[model samples]
Target chain A: MYPANKYYVKGFVMSSYSERLNEYISMVNNELDRLLPEQRIPQQVVIDAMRYSLLSGGKRIRAVLVLEFCRMCGGDVAAALPIACAVEMLHCYSLIHDDLPCMDDDDLRRGRPSCHIAFGEANALLAGDGLLTLAFETILSSRNLAPEQIVKAAGVLSKAAGYQGMVGGQTVDLQNEGKPISGETLEYIHALKTGALIRAAVQMGCITAKADEGLCSGADEYAEKIGLSFQIIDDILDIVGFAQEMGKPVGSDRNNDKTTFATLYGVDKARQIVKTLNDEAKALLKRFPKANEFIYEFTDSLTSRTC
Target chain B: MYPANKYYVKGFVMSSYSERLNEYISMVNNELDRLLPEQRIPQQVVIDAMRYSLLSGGKRIRAVLVLEFCRMCGGDVAAALPIACAVEMLHCYSLIHDDLPCMDDDDLRRGRPSCHIAFGEANALLAGDGLLTLAFETILSSRNLAPEQIVKAAGVLSKAAGYQGMVGGQTVDLQNEGKPISGETLEYIHALKTGALIRAAVQMGCITAKADEGLCSGADEYAEKIGLSFQIIDDILDIVGFAQEMGKPVGSDRNNDKTTFATLYGVDKARQIVKTLNDEAKALLKRFPKANEFIYEFTDSLTSRTC
Candidate 1:
């Protein structure tokens, strides 16, 4: 599950935090659009499918984490921009594959027809494959990073996205559908399914900034807290949030009989857990030498988001 | 359209070239087995699926190209073994995806149930995802190469595997199924779908060897000729090859009403083209200063295979 757009909450007002978030979102969106491959003859549809899902607007939270963490670690945001986009590309690929008929079979994503629905199943499959491969291609294309740094960053990403991480988690999740799973099993699934990539995002930013080992460890711990909280928020939203804001049907988790935090512990307890985890995440951020007020607000804002 | 097992062909006897090729295959298989992820909790099935396809026996020609080119360019074979396995991992992933029901819908691979048929569509899909991501992880995990060389080799691989290459060619191949297509389009498809990775295998080898640009270019030219001939041979095999030796059913291309070199140019003419192209490829190899007698014999052996 990913964070949704909260800019249009009923009583929300644009603050400096909102403005900076918007700026980061715009920068990432522009770069993603610029980096998308041109539609060459005979293979234009595959490229079109890739662009359609990639450019479809979301909050760009994963990408923002990469840039904001880099900035927090005293790294050049421009230098980390490609890495930021790479994570987003990888995330988009997961979403596409997760929506396939043989998988979750979802008909929509971010309030639009899913990749398989918009493009036929075959092209959609290839689109996911393309995006996954392109994620690595994008990372290696970064001109500002040293080759060592690039290799390290790619290793982090590939581990997060590979069999031991996201794909492995998805396999378990699908296999357990409609079965009674324990709390520990659920946690393991979420930790690998989503937590791994979030941790990689923070760690990659630190590596790009040449942060110390201790700082990387601290950052990873912070990422773990926020990533879990993010998932809890997602479960809560599925039960109580608006479809218009959430960009997908509400209560689909319950409809599918999925065992989420809300289903296991109830929404109130899940909210409590999110608050505690996010607070700890923000507190952990304070240990970083270059952490700033904007970073604090950004970390806290996810806890209060309705969408 | 990979090269089939030729060592077991009637009247074929083990020679120095075969012995060395077998040695390379055994090394790659051992390394791949060692590198495969342990069967972790709740995710064991995905790993099983990944291993099932990857360890299925093939000639390992693409991987051999990586190692042989590295050797031909005077590089350490041990240092490049991981790269060789990386290309093999990538090839296996592509085959898994290509056999999916939403794609080519084949029910068999390497004389067994295809990945989707063996593991179910969803797990097979994740298995392919796992292998593709693992390919990059395997490359970066190498400790023998310089960081720059690793980065360069990874870049070559990602480009060959991504939208502009393998995936793009697959898209066109699927779109043109059961339809009339020109020779130019057929060439375009084969060049990207198969040739790109073959070219990358050679290029990555040269990069690992620190070969000069002149030698890299010549290696690439040789790879191109052999790669094209490889496809033409595949088409020829589809028409005349034995199912027992070819592993999958022969003439399935015709069964599926697919356009192929044999269909477009006739088997005799396709064979003639293969002979001419392979001769040119072998002659080009003679230009590499360290190219050995075994390398030439190996190249020629492919042209005369019956499987």
Candidate 2:
């Protein structure tokens, strides 16, 4: 499934990065399934809609980041797995809400119909609400983590997903859509809209691992850079990448008349920024002695990926 | 505002139930304002939308339940106040989503335009999401509560608000709309949709108070009965209550073609049931020696209120 890993694994003494990441992704998927299995109740439709969007295959980058960061911080990955899944759930909920007709209004996600298209708008809305609620439930219910850690992690997650974070970012994005916006405004949108959650994933991992302030800040800095680059790559891909690989149709930003890094800075400059951010992100990771070769390769891959 | 309470305040030795309840309501409103003040940022629109719906005055029944139950269980009201605000936030979030054009399609809430009507659909949707996320954040960020208790209370909240609880009930209610449904189905819907959170409010208060299981169970039983009666009263209100007092159009259930206890059982039977349930609910409160006369009056008031 991840055959490209063979070429990237040359310098790594441990198992290939793809293998480990795949294992974490699989763990997340299985845990999600177990946590939100289908039921035969009358309200099963909402659960089905939630699972449909939640289980749809994406890169699972957030989950991988969570587990990898925890592992890098010398934390128990097993205990961190639930937090990883929680971040993914939060991500999916945001995606579902963002695709609604009143928002981005995208009809497709992950190469399939968006949640509202697949499920009616009402159920899709409820599904998103359910997923968001379930994310907190997942964190609070997690075992092997201390109560203080769970509370801290859940608080971090809620703040990242709330008005001060992703929702705020989305609001500003919506307000600025179809209008010319400055590069600073674009960065602000991306920072809260995408960067906050990505940073939260790293922070939650560190919290679960009981990492010190120094280590946590370092991971957060690394995450912030990568988060920006990830969005920049997403912007670039929307303009130039293949629809099949990306799953959703390309040129969506243009269609929505929304500004992006590629649009605001031009594709050439955006590409350069991605490289710079990726390098800076990877450099920050070097501060963690325990962070293995896989983390570096993973960071590098984000800037170069076509999809 | 609560002149009627003067007539009912004769038997209470401490402050009148209305005064106590009003004080709790005021405390909740203040805390919510403090926690989610209007911000002057690009994302301020979303915050405004959130504050719009959140600050809209309702009966504050859930907040009162949290504070009153905590007080009855010998918990510090100040410590429990945050949880009270959290429940109200959760309730408001649900109300916002439920009133969306996609869901209940309500244009009016609390005598004014619904969140979606005032803010555009997109911002309203985000406001609902924001509030829901903030609810958990409020609970997790609550000071003075033990970590274990906070986790337990938050877990209870997330479950009540998630797919298996309020969302599930909403889904089923939506599915059954315009379709003939039995009394059993209505009971199930009311239980999850309204009963779950009401029960959670009581349970959260008990958990915060470190109330024993016996007390929790007794309180839960009281809550469950009132919850059902509360819904039954809502159904009745939709049929016969004054729009000016109810703060929304009457006969919406009939307009939406929704089946309710008032429709399923004739108004007289429904009225009788409310009385029975209210009495039973008040009877359960007798097990709590620490519970004050305010609780008993509060229980009886739900069945008799016009709004």
Candidate 3:
């Protein structure tokens, strides 16, 4: 929107960004596979549904954020690995539930049939519940973190994922579906729906590294800006992106009559917001000399076009 | 199938037992109300759904178990109250999910409209998920318990409530619906679907007390016996008890063509099993002299006639 008459501006992603993302994504996938229960006899169907949905291909963005932040803070990632995986598992659970017929009614996700489509609604529901429970259990099983840290992490994740966070946001989103909500309302929804977990990811990075309060507070502000920016970009992508690149079909939000950031602010203004957010996030990253490069590239990579 | 020609036997409930339960229920209800989220604006719909299902009238058996077990071990209940509430929250969440259309397809629970029926499917689903998250959140928020105890409680509750326990059992039940299953399989399903959480409640009680390993193991065995016994009695009640007394329609198990203890073992034998398990539970209870009277009355109360 800021680039004159261009409706969608595709930022050129650095080749090195792709390389880092792929390597980190691979690492996350391996750890996820190692941590998840094996699909075996007696509970095969349930475990299969769990593994299928959890191990399903994705960007591993949340896990990467946790790991990257910890690394930036000069902490060993092995200490934060389970926490990283926990966030991903929690995110996956939300995705499964959001795809349910009663929720968003989507059949496709990440270029494949959604969990409910593959496992049937009942099993899909259980799989979501299972994955969510496993996230907390996985966090508890983290060997490196002290019990106090584990308690803090679990408390943060649950609060972010619970009714006051993701689920709370989903409720508002559902209730407001087909109705025109105020721009403020839309922001509130997005903040809770997506922002809470994102903020928690950054906080966990601080928690694992036992970082200073200053860094933690800085991370909070950075997360909020980036989180809103990310959702806005997602809204923009839903309008202008390809179905193949996005996994699900395009324009479902428009079809559902959802009041989105793009709908309220216009595509151009939304993109402008995204640019502002990216700059602000980069500005915050600048404070941590070591975190600057990777954080900038990692965040910058999200808003850029995939196809 | 049992002693002489008694195909089924219903024990007479003591007035004294009812008095004790009523007092305990009142106390637990107050704690639950204290613990649950208030009906607040901005996300009132979701919070309302949560409060509705959680505060819906029911026997506070799970909560009482946690409280009583702590008391039996001579610990201050103030330290265990949040944990008591946590287990109840977990139980309530399971009930909500189990009643979903794709799962049990229930439209009624506890003599009232089921969560989905009352709150709509999407909200009900979120309510269930919210409650599950809250269970852990509630545990972490325990002010009196140490961080380590909180960690241990969260671990036990999540494992018991997760895929390997309740969710896993529900999966098996759904897969085997209307199909023949072995007695061993039925036992496995009940143990996970119901027994797991039951065990957790008792274990949390022991954890809160900081009990010795011997007492913990004893609690485990006692929980196992009473848990199975309780489910067997529930199966019996579903066949012989009135719908009004039970709060929901009966024979749905039969209508659904699902196999139960009664279906496989015969009513008299099921009753016989209940008696045996009750004896075993009591035998274990006797070892903890301080826990004897309350534990006996509570477990016995569950199996006896209520109306």
DockQ of all models, two decimals each: 0.83, 0.87, 0.70
Best candidate, DockQ-wise? 2
Question: Over the stretch A141-192, how does candidate 3's per-residue lDDT look in tens digits?
Answer: 8888888888998899999999889998999888899999998889889899
Worst 10 residues of 2 chain B by lDDT: B1-10
Cα lDDT, all candidates: 0.88, 0.88, 0.84
- Per-residue lDDT tens digits for candidate 3, residues B217-260, read 99999999888988888888788878987788998888877789
Model 3 CA deviation exceeding 4 Å by range: A1-19, B1-20
Better model by DockQ, 2 or 3? Answer: 2
Q: Lowest lDDT 10-mer window, candidate 3 chain B?
A: B1-10
Q: Quick one: ranking by DockQ, best first?
A: 2, 1, 3
- Weakest lDDT window of 10 consecutive positions for candidate 2 chain A: A1-10
lDDT by residue (B72-171, candidate 2, tens digit) is 8887777887788889989999998999888888899999999998999999999989999999998898878999999999999999999989999999
Q: Which runs in model 2 stand beyond 4 Å of their true positions? A: A1-12, B1-12
Candidates 1 and 3: which is better by TM-score? 1
Worst 10-residue lDDT window, candidate 1 chain A: A1-10
Give the lDDT of residue A194 in candidate 1.
91
Candidate 2 residue pairs in backbone clash: none
Estimate, for each residue in B49-155, the C-alpha lDDT of model 1 and write its tens digit. 99999998988888888888887888877788889999999999999999999999999999999999999999999999999999999999888899999999999
List pairs with backbone clashes in candidate 3.
A1-A268
